[model samples]
Target chain A: MRWFWFDRFTEFESGSHATSVKNVSLAEEQVHDHFPGAGTMPNSLILEGLAQTSGMLVAEYYDFQERVILAKVPRLRFHLRAVPGDTLIYRAKIDSIEESGARVSVTSHRGEELQAEAEIIFAHLDRHAEQRQLFEPNDFAKLLRTFGVFEVGRKPDGSRIRMPAHLAEAEARYRSQAQA
Target chain B: MPTQDEIFHKVQSALVDALGVDEDEVKPEATLVGDLGAESIDFLDIVFRLEKSFDIKIPRGELFPEDILTNADYVVDGKINDAGLEQLKKRMPFADLTGFEKNPAVQDFATMLTVQDMCNYVASKVDGKA
Candidate 1:
């Protein structure tokens, strides 16, 4: 199963970069599992959140046309442990985009305090060669919308980016069905 | 270079995998969303599969030209004028606009996009003609 660590995007720039937020809540199931009463958000989960943030940014470069798998964590540094009620702000910037893969620099913050930083590499998998679909498009689209990828996304020039026509139509259908 | 038939077959397979639709439903004339039940997210999956399959790069807004609607020069009185229509036609040469041209509502543009259109677009890109 695919994992979506981040909650939603607050700022999305197609191809170049993106920013998302994840609220670590006491109610999360993992919190109880990690510690019986402490309820601390694990540092690994924080790294996963950074991965989700940067992964989406890299995927958008191909218009989500390729399978972007996390290849490596060349570097990572954690400054603090997070508890419930802490909001993690993840920012990902493209270091370079290439045909083989992409390199992204990511940092996580907790309200003016640095929580963690990392450099991640993603491999663009050839789905055709694999002959396997990693995600159902409908489910993936809903995930993108739920994360506000299209709602706040923009071009480098600062113009609002339009959601692809097919995605817009699907979102409309989902909305109507949700209302019904 | 892959033949048009190969491209079409690959495109159909991609759509079937991405949208979870039957192979029989992915006909050339079938509308992706209308007939085949593709949602917006499916397009991303389809494009991704196609790019990986064909070993090509598809820029955002190239396969689906939503940016045209945002261009002021193309939209006049809330409708696409001749120039706008021409530009769209050039961008999406595979789409059949016969019915859309008759009515020309902004919504019709997306609705008019068909399975054959995507197949053609991928073919063009693979052939280095796009």
Candidate 2:
């Protein structure tokens, strides 16, 4: 099963905030057997959508130089159940970010109603050279494209955000290795 | 400058939000690990919330000194030596090391962090500014 919870990002501002949309559908595998006859999207998966939306924002803030991993969810409260046909909009705002990690405030909304809110944390592991391949820069860059991050992403100065050089280099190397 | 009680309350609120513990469970002498059940990751969460609540920049290693714990020179057989304890004391003046001084076990050090110590640490950071 794919871990892609969000469909596309409508708003992405590097480091500060980002908004993404997720369309719940019974056709998807995640909600197939959630309740058998009556399937509803798992709250955990909704949380994942929120995290991914925010995690990408945080990762882009540092130009993807650091390996970002979700460390904790300090607070999360679900106000409504998200079922098939519901379009959930997840918004993630960076409250504080530093070299060590970042703290993000995320919320999920269905139209005008607030579905969920949370405070999530991320930790950086750039110093771990041995585990550098874990992030798989090429695959990550592709994932960003699939999620439409680059299309809507912008820098703090309002300039369009560009893909990092490292990811491009990694993709080139991977293609060469595959050909070889 | 905020009063001691105000600092304690703010610290308490941060702990409650971070650890998902009850407001009453957070007391002066309540051990963060033992009583409130805060794991290593929760410390980062607590620090983040505290920074947000108090609006102060808490540089890494100021609130929790992980470096001393991990240093080979300080730790021996999963225990902190007297010299190590001295360094820890210098790093965390707000913490009362008298109790932990006896055991000085590395694992037990986390459990020694009482809520009062956190308040003291915040007080030291915010008070000195005033």
Candidate 3:
């Protein structure tokens, strides 16, 4: 509910797309007992990884007050098992947005391989209320500020990805860090 | 606050609830791989259960070498032996969740677990029939 699984928003574009990453480590307790000798990264968390990443996109669309939960996972598949040391890159492209909830097509990749993919539907809920809240006054500025919308990424060759104009300055700074 | 043994027992019971494996299958000495035959996704579902049950995050990391990850025997061969289990048990931090603010995933690993811990986690996630 708190988007506890993923962190570090590398690329966040307003009104369209987003990308986030979760670094997996071997020291995890689940790794030790998971299979004794063959501790593997769990898929649900990988799904959680994707959900948390995409959820951030949806969460950013609303102000921080709303908690986004996966109402339905219409389609999801695990192509591979991501291990520790693997950084899961979650990318979500918004298919549509409605008043009650929105739909997102999410992809989870471990480097080049598509680790998992899902079509997720998220319902927006108020933090205080038991049921979901229908709407809130739009806050584009707060979404950009809280979600670190300035950070951006590039292709291997160094061309910048598509992003909003306001984030251009932040993008330049991020590119410097990415290069460094 | 639950003592280590109590925590261990609670974890064991949770595994039985989730995975449905016999309690004897999840003893401290049991191997999660050769003894239990859990797949990777099974491990994930189990962790979610443990998190839900104990209210914790299992610290994550890259443990196995890249070449060995997909191999079935690596887990069954006791690659992470009792010595490793002891090291894992020692690493379970009793610190507050606030310590995890630096990295939320760290909360996932607060409890030092044995193969039994993994079993309980796996068991708790499943319908408790396996």
- Per-residue CA lDDT of model 1 for A109-175, tens digit only, reads 9999999998786877866678676676667787887899879999888887666666567667878
Q: Interface root mean square deviation of every model, in Å?
A: 9.8, 0.8, 10.7
Please give the lDDT score at residue A64 for candidate 1: 77
TM-score order of candidates, top first: 2, 1, 3
**Second chain alone, TM-score for each candidate:** 0.89, 0.96, 0.47
Candidate 1 C-alpha error for residue A41, in Å: 0.8
> DockQ of all candidates, in order?
0.02, 0.77, 0.02
B1-130: candidate 1 lDDT, tens digit per residue: 8887888899888877667788999899999888987765456556656777888888878877878876889887778888888998888786777787777767656677888888878877877853
Candidate 3 segments whose C-alpha is farther than 4 A from its true place: A1-3, A126-180, B1-130
Candidate with top DockQ is 2
User: Model 1 compared with the native: what TM-score?
Assistant: 0.54
The numbered model that scores best in TM-score is 2
Docking class for candidate 3 = incorrect
- In terms of lDDT, the best-performing candidate is 2
lDDT of each: 0.81, 0.90, 0.56
**Model 1 stretches astray by more than 4 angstroms:** A1-3, A165-180, B1-130
* Candidate 1, lDDT over the whole model: 0.81
